[model samples]
Target: MDIELYHDSKYGNGARVAEEFKRLAETKGSNVNIHHVREAGSKNLPRADLYVFGSPTHFGKATRGIMRFVKKLELPPGTKYAVFGTFSGAAPDKKTGKMPSEEELEKRRRTIPMIDEALRSKEMAKVAEMRFFVKPENLKGPLEDGWQKIVEEFVVAILGK
Candidate 1:
């Protein structure tokens, strides 16, 4: 399957994670394209069997650029999708003994439902499935080591890898 990961990161985390997603997406020998939303011109998103949108969460929602782009986009019939995002903050400390893995941390780096909720609210019922990720500050990455597994597994299922 062909995939395109279009993302916007005023904070650059979206693009960073998108790159990693691109790498994982291609591992299965599928054709995957990654684009930065900042450099995207117009809503003319690419043709892909699947779309993975990554954006920096804003006020617990997807970024304005992503929202505008999605608003203007009409997926080719039969398109499937997933979403990911990045944020800068410390989540409420959980008292659990298990520390969330790096990717899980990134997945929770920010809440993505704001964007997902808005998508449904805007009548985006075609999204076959949805998943999200969050990352921390300027360091190794929210995608550290274990994080890739979250998205990689999602891709394997979507693409049947």
Candidate 2:
């Protein structure tokens, strides 16, 4: 399958994960292309059997650039797509030393739904979704431990292997 991963990264976390996804997809014998959202203009997106999107979670949603890209995206009806987000997990508040509540954590990981909605507007079929939490200490991350397994699972699911 021809796969394209278009991503926006802040602090490199999103790009890091996107690269891993690309590597994994390639290993599975699928032809995959990776593009930074800025580099892949909406008018010039390459043809692909599957479209993947990645972005760092910002203010509980995909970045404005990604949203705008999706809004202007031109894809055929029923195009297969997937979304991934690099999110910051809750850390203890400096003042109270308390972590965010479960609801807050869920809200903060809202990037997936927002991206999915945008893809849906283009009449795309979402095939997969993933959220890789970043380590809070450095802010920038090599994702949390066990990320390899997550990526592996995503590859399998997307490829239907």
* Count of backbone clashes, every candidate in sequence: 6, 0
Q: Mind giving the per-residue lDDT tens digits that candidate 2 earns over 5-60?
A: 88889788778777788888888899888888887788767889999998888878
Candidate 1 backbone collisions, by pair: 103-147, 106-134, 106-135, 107-133, 107-134, 109-134
Candidate 1: TM-score? Answer: 0.67
Where does model 2 exceed 4 Å of error? none
Error of 2 at 6 (Å): 0.1
**CA lDDT scores, all candidates in order:** 0.62, 0.85
Q: What is the TM-score of each candidate against the true structure?
A: 0.67, 0.93
